[model samples]
Target: MYILIRYAALSGKRTATLFPDTPVAVACSLLFKFVLNVFYGTIVVENEHYIPKNGEPVIVCSNHVNSLTDALLLVTSVSSKKRNFLRLTAKDSQFGRKTFSSWLIENAGTLPIQRRKEHGDQADNSTTMDKLLTALSEGDAICLFPEGMSRFHPTMAPLKTGVARIVSDVLTRNRDNPEFAVTLLTCSLTYVHRWSFRSDVLVSFNPPLKLTVKDTPSLISTPDKPVDFEAIKSLTTFMHAQLSSNTIDSPSWDLVRVAKTAARIYVPLGTRMRLGDWVRVVARFVEGLAKPVEGTGAGTGGEGVAIERQGMKRTAYQDQLNALGLKDDRIRQSITLSRIKILWRLFLRICQTCLFLAIAAPGLFLWVPVFATTTYKSEQLKRSGPVWDTHDEVAQTKLVYGLASGIFVWLTAIILTTPIFGLGLFFTIWFVPAWMWLTLRWTEDLIAAFRAAVALYRLLWVSKADLKRLRETREDLHGRVMNVATEVLGLPKDPEAEFLVVEGEEGDDQPSRWAKHQRGRTRGGWDSALRYFSIRRRRKRDWNETLRWFDATEFPKE
Candidate 1:
């Protein structure tokens, strides 16, 4: 399945390269996407017209919310014929052509990235930065998921330093060239029925912006204050600004709709399902196969009745298999959130372990002490109040006292002249065990930070699983509704859309979904329920909901 996607991307690249400008490439992407949707279903491109028609060395930075398909989605959103090819930044794991990821090599000329320790795993066997910098210098337009990897979240996640780094490098290198002002544009993808028909997924584009180094606070700093911390702040703001202007008001499911539309209406895969004004509604025929075959009066009371839901348009040709199928294979259930999160978890675990072990190795252990303590202290010295600020004359006195004691240790160790005294003499020879102290502190901080990260990831994992189950219930409910849509009151032929409005309206009127979420989380088989009720009777809402999130799907899916 993944191979087919890579195949389409590669073919699209070859097809798009024939044309000039980025638009053709986008067009080719669209065509290729259109092609893939034949079997994949439709991917509706919403607000895509917002993508800029022209720009200098532009970047289409979108929230990397899904799979590699985001790359092609960008291409097609603009045009299929433009040739200003786009190169994507991919992790180093996809480094070589070793069968499984071989197609990745063929399709996306994905620039392999191996991180340089910036606080993850001090693991840098390969310099992905050099490669990324090299690519920037190559003058090709590219896109990066500043978050580093596709993440699961209701809204756009936090910006990472990478985007800032890329912008800084380009601006710094091309300081004098007007053309060097790299245009960074944000593309906010709002998925509708992400994998089904009539998706209202939107790909809104914001005006391109520039990241200039001249905007920094004094590329240099004053005594005691040693870093250009504000510069990072400015760059971070730019990332938010890049997409802020383009984001539209919508919920999670909206994006699914858009993605599904684009997915289906897209071009064919291989050469088997090309488009020309019409598609084999054979794909469209299954539009609601889940419905009864004939007013509940056919085989098995009409349950055996088959339907094929592809785009309603009939194509020039139909595959015999599709024709013979008991159902319309065009539209399909979207890849569930559970599945996507599972994959994300797998990817994250692998990557995190690689990061952890690499950073934890002996080579790093040698410096861990330095990074942990001394460096952190140095930084603290820069940020904290002056040592004398406590006006605690006591601190200065301690400093003096400790200094005198150090000198006394040297004198005493010298006088003792024993091997143990020699060791004391050696330590006292230097200042405050300073050499080993920094790295030790740094290691502790690193461990704490990783602990926080692991904690955060655990929390996220629980949330991911819980959310998936909740969504499954909702989707299952949706499935049930569809199976009985025509039969239900207040429902449409496609009631999911209607359910959306109901959900939205309820969202507005509810007394804080968070509150409801907490109550919902209590596990129960009557006893647990009784316990929850007892606890609820004594606790007020404020303190209760703050720490408890047992609602929305119970205990989270850890």
Candidate 2:
């Protein structure tokens, strides 16, 4: 144990000192990359070219959303062969804890800031500042969450002045050095479903902003006048403006949720919208609603009342569906299903579900403990903690506890199996984690397929009258939402026309030989399995195509 501790300390020191292209840094990056990839189903990095390649000081400023995940994402995503590791500033208490977390932080190249007086003194602050300046002077990349605290807010909090101060100090000290240059790069992290397992994350990096002596001359303070209040304030305001523009922020998530629901129906059925695009559309809609119209009293009072009424109506509709024993998927199918193909699709789904269930049995048993612990702990936290009181805290507890439980369970399994495996313990431990991850992914897919099948069955077998009513209600809701979207977003009357475009010619609709083979395959009695896999691939391809079209035509280039 003593030797292990000493080795950990040595490893931490090496990790801290290693350059980006070094074996240690490369290995750490790969480890973090794998972990993040497993944690998120999809991670889309926008404007990756914006990351500066040449050896020059760069500060990456991002909004704090997910606690440790935010920092990890930034570190792993920004890769460079010329530069060393991206240094980060973390709370001093994290380092002082003398636990596994401290070891992790030290190895991750985190510069600790004193938060509590008891944990860190004046000297510690000075030391941290000096280290930051030294790192900047050496042309290393530094990442800091200017908001200082990670919260579950839809928007960024008012940024603290620490980042601005660091920049100013670095500039002031390096003013005499002719080669001194630093750039501020703003990054935004948007999660489709933050707390949900296998959710998508979008990381966007804005163009780097270079600060010259001419930009903020007040930062050039003399020895007698060390504090440059004006420079600090100006720099902070500038950073906030740049960061906020890149980030999506709203006063209320409830309003945003309402807008998102309304926006969903505006798009074509089976068309998958990018999460980032959906967020921007909702934010813009809310902004338009909040604007004071000349003839109409449609500012805060009118818009707020409208959204509240819409929320209540949606609740009522959900309750009505619940009374009919229909869930979201069932309602969706009921609304979107074509009358002609419904029976055929339902038959196909039934066959597919049987095959899916047969394959999913092993995964179901393997991942049950993970799911049970996560669900139970999440519910417990929601009920007992402050997570229930505020939107910011809603998923925070669940994410924390869920991650802890997963690690603990995996470790426990490894330990228990070690006695039996003995010499093969290492291999068993490695295989188990991979198996667990696969089990989780399989279970999720299985559950989704089962739910879709059940929804189709409900549409066909039970409550035809209720299904018809639900479809009518959905139509009404869609019409209302379209009207609002048309007025606010200036969308064309036929929004589907805007999204759907011919790839080649109107007559070129025939499927290729490979496509036909994929559609009609029954080898090893897995025709249904093949079809399910094809559907998944098709959906992903369609979604990517939709995003590409939007980027090309709908959204303006940055």
User: Top model by lDDT, which number?
Assistant: 2
Alpha-carbon lDDT of model 1: 0.38
- Candidate 1 is scored at a TM of 0.37
lDDT per residue for candidate 1 within 130-202, as digits (tens), equals 6545545554456776655553333456777666656665665555554455567777654322222112234
Question: Cα lDDT for residue 207, model 2?
Answer: 68
Question: How do all models score by TM-score?
Answer: 0.37, 0.72
Over 4 Å off in model 2, which ranges?
A: 1-29, 80-84, 96-103, 116-124, 177-179, 223-231, 269-271, 290-344, 372-384, 388-434, 460-473, 490-558
- Tell me how many clashing residue pairs each candidate has: 85, 0
lDDT value, candidate 2, whole model: 0.57
The collision pairs in model 2 are: none
